[model samples]
Target chain A: MAWVWFHRFGSPPHFYRLATRLTPWFAWPAALLCLAGLIGGLVLAPPDYQQGDGFRIIYVHAPAAWLSLMVYVVMATSAAVGLIWRMTVAYAVSASCAVIGASFTALALATGMLWGRPMWGTYWEWDPRLTSELLLLFLYLGYLGLRNSIDDVGRADRASAVLAIVGVVNVPIIHYSVIWWNSLHQAPSVMKFGRPTMPAAMLVPLLLMLAGFTAYFVALLLIRARGELLRRERNAHWTAEAAGATATG
Target chain B: MSEQRVGFAAAAAALIARDLRLALRRSGDTLQPLGFFLVVTALFPLALDPQLSLLRDIAPAALWVGALLSSLLALDLLFREDAQDGTLEQLALCGLPFQGLLLAKTAVHWLLTGLPLVLIAPLAATALGAPYEAMPGILAAVLLGTLALSLIGAVGAGLTMSLKRNGSLLALLVLPLAAPVLIFGARATALAIAGEPLAAPLYLLAAFTVLSATLAPWALAAAVRIGLE
Candidate 1:
């Protein structure tokens, strides 16, 4: 019985309709939360004693970094689902996640550099997390490049899915090895993140921003997945009705 | 059951033997990446200040990066040739475990490309002013690191087998995935050069090789099947 709902969900027409219907549900909340989180973080939260306003970049940097990692996991999971079940909707979701994920990863790195220049006295540091995030960006680009270069949609989907899965398996090992390398080099000074007990005022806005970013990703994913579904299903008969319904309704 | 096991081993051996023969027939093709490795390492000294102290300091990174680029140079030979000649399709339809067949192919890749890199590493490192005592460490690190890279690159090769212009795309896809191998391999070499205990990084490199050895063939097999499709 549950499988029936899953199969229906995997169907292109069903997914298209559901995604279109659901986009507003996520989009409105995402907008409101991000607005609230920004106001609260930038205005409400107290400045850190050490770094002052320079630390405020964390509100953007932390969430972008989190989304960067989260989106890859989402992509890999959907890619796996697509490969295992041959679900077109899953592939569409995976495809929609890549560009968004790469953008967030770039945001994280840029913000990290902005924060690092004043804090670390350098624009870049070979810190493990930073290095791993840079590599994560490269991995995303690789996935997108592989997908774009392959001419056949089915072949591209399966091949990039294999790459995504392989990447997911390697991420942890990469992270660990980078950490080991960092330990060997042992930088002059380490940048400590939040205190052992972060104040609620500061923590609340960060949590709100994280939630907001997640909601925003879902909203964007639904919108993009709808378009992806349309492209993949151009020849399917239901697309005509779906297009018409969207045009009128 | 014993007979079936023997049959599997024989099949794997035959596959390895076939690839080795192909590699030998095109000896220049086999040697070309090694030559690239030598040139890449040689370029570093010319590009940067060739001070003995600086060279010693950067030798680990230099040798490891060279190994990486050269291995990438040969990755196409892993599956592209077989794919072009339709051997991939036959192997897929041969009614054997596809992953095992790929593992045999990857093993052959390691023998032709990876092993020679390992043998040449100490020479390259020494020329770069790496200490004589570091020779065994450099040798071991290269041996294990190159094997891990071959296994990893096989999947990339399989992924790109059907593409018309795959050289750069193959590097783009494989290099990020192979970053950990570089990190561990270079660190091990650095530790050897600095006269530190090399056990930790060497152990990590070995573990990574074992992990890739176990998993990459499955990924490569899946990729080959998809490319063939």
Candidate 2:
């Protein structure tokens, strides 16, 4: 039944209904996790042995950075699924993810520069990691621009899908650009497999924050997906009812 | 065992020949990109100083960037006429591969736009006081990189022709993806100006060209088919 419900999510009306009902299921946990993680990260967690409190920015920055990339992969994958299956619902989901992903990427970059200003001695550097993130933002803007430029939804989807797939090559490029181009931004110290660079206390809060962000994204994505589905499916009877309720409310 | 596979050399030559003839009788179609390239290249010198050292340093990047934008400027012209006049539909209906036609068009575009840039670059490089050594690197990079630019631009052009004011939209699509090409090309020429080894970055430029050449036409064909459908 759960799997069946998951399958029904591709239907706009069903998904809209389910999302409205289950928004709380994700929201409560996301809020709780974020609140706890922020508290742990800000006060309870020990100051970095070297950098003191400055390192705490990682609690927010790292998870947002991870989501920035994760959201992109999700968007691209959904786009591919839409193109392959010719599913309008999947394209709607992909388009919604792109906006959320772009914002998260901007957050990650903004906070990263804030940390870098004090730590790296500069607010901006052409560091591959930072530059790649900037490029990712441009790719997102370009996708949206292309989407909006095409008034036709079907053509927009196909065009944006091609752009998404091609732009995906940059994900690997950006991921590896640090190694390839040589930059000051150090590689991931926490997500490594063997062991984390920081102590367990730092690592735990960071992981919790990451989980909190994951939940946040899932909740936001479903909400936006519902909006997109309603817009695209407004001709359908279910959409009219959903639109009516949302409008009145 | 009946028919031999067509070599790239032969196929490329055939395609290039086809486009040259198409543009020869229809010469006005090709002039806009050339004029745009000249005007854009001329803009930087006027907007900025004409000092030799300054021009020398910025020359390679400006020339390459101009070439890139001009080629992209011309990209919309690649498919719009075909699409507008329903020649694209006929091409689709024709037995010959549509991808081949796209490739042929791109090859022509490179020849018309790219070759002229290479030929004109030496003079422009002189105007900017680009050292003689920077000449080959600049020419080679622009020649190969512009081909890839048009190739990818063809894909973007195909996607956007069905839309309104597609020229600006085409640039938004192609320029971001073209960043690596432009960067590598500019850096390679810059390194040459400073008398450094460029073999490594030149290899990257060549690889980009090959990669785009092999892939972009297929994507363009797909976009055109989707638009038609």
Candidate 3:
């Protein structure tokens, strides 16, 4: 009985039914959290003493950077699951992950460039973090490219899985490359190994924003997965039956 | 080749020699990448300040980047010709494991494409006015690194060999995956010439090559098998 959840989740029909039931639960809370976080972030979070109003960009930028990595890890894990379990649902979850992660990475880069214009006095820097972030975007693109270039769905999943697993090694390398070398980027601050660099006043909003961003990503990922699953499972009778049930329900 | 008579080394060498002869026959294919190498490197001096010191400064990265871009220029040939002519089917039918076949392909690539790049690199290094001390490191890094690239690229090429429009698609797939090699090789050359510790970057490059050599062929063979399926 306890393992039934896994058995249910593993079935396409069961997963679709589960997704349908879970959608609004994720959707409403994610929306509410995002709206509240946005308002609280914009109005309540204190301005950085150094950068003033410009540092407001952190409310969005930090979360995007965080999601950029979070999505990659999720995708890689899903890919790992797909490889080990030979599960098509796992592949769909990862495929959806690529779309969402690439968007987050692009947003992070764009927001960083905007932040740079005001804070760093330049739109671009050959800085380590910036360069590595840019590379992350390329890695995502390469993953998608590997998928599209292969016509067979199974082979595409396996090939891109290999690419994702290999590319994750770059994530730590990208993070530490700055600290390890002479990168123009700043060293790790509040997120350092020790205690938070900033007091709770600042930390609270950042934490809230992280929660908001993660919920938002979960909501988006589920929707995207549902769509991809539908497409991939179209020829299967489970999809037809699920569609019939949804129509009646 | 009986079980007791034929060893792995002998088999690998024979396969490597076979591929080398094939590549040597219509070796105009080899010259394409060499030309691309020269022309792309030609752009760097034109685009950047060609002051002798400046050229010397960026020479390592430019060399590594040029090699990367050019090595990939001919990567589609890694399995395309064989797959198209039914030779891949024959090779697959051969008793030799795909890993051995993949290793042989990389060796022949080193001889045909990568070897010429090494020969021409001294000329390019001089033309760019890189310090004399950097020359040995540059050549060594490119040679080792490009061998690794050929091996990795073969995996991608084998996967896409049967797909239509493999040429451009091959570049798209292989180049991004090969980024670390370019970065590591270029940095290794630069640091060594600057009287820095050669051990670290050299070890990293070697690890990358060793890992790629050990792992990429099995993946390539799996990819080829999947493609055939």
- Using lDDT, give the best candidate's number: 1
Please, what is the TM-score per model?
A: 0.95, 0.85, 0.88
* Predicted candidate 1 versus true structure: per-residue lDDT over A1-249, tens digit per residue: 869999999999998998889999999998889898899899999998888888788889999999999999999999999999999999999999999999999999999888889988999999888999999999999999999999888789899999999999989888888887888778644566566677888888888899999999999999999888887887999988877756554
Tell me each candidate's i-RMS in Å: 0.8, 2.1, 2.9
- Per-residue lDDT, model 3, residue A32, is 76
lDDT of 3 by residue, A83-187 (tens): 778777788888889988999999999988888887667888556656678878888887887788777777888777866776675567545543444332254
Error of 2 at B19 (Å): 4.9
Descending-DockQ candidate ranking = 1, 2, 3
Q: Which stretches of candidate 3 lie over 4 Å from their true place?
A: A1-7, A174-195, A245-249, B1-10, B89-96, B192-197
- Each model's DockQ? 0.83, 0.41, 0.37
Error of 3 at B142 (Å): 2.0
TM-score of decoy 1: 0.95
Residues B151-187 of candidate 1 have per-residue lDDT tens digits of 9999999999889976588999999989988988998
The per-residue C-alpha lDDT of model 2 at residue B95 equals 55
Q: Which tens-of-lDDT digit does each residue in B122-229 have in candidate 3? A: 778777776677777777777778887888788777767777755466666676667667767877777756756666666777877887788787777767766665
DockQ of 1: 0.83
Which candidate would rank higher by DockQ, 1 or 3? 1
Error of 2 at A26 (Å): 2.7
Weakest ten-residue segment in model 2 chain B by summed lDDT: B3-12
Clashing residue pairs in candidate 3 (N, C-alpha, C atoms within 3 angstroms): none
TM-score of chain A of each: 0.95, 0.88, 0.88
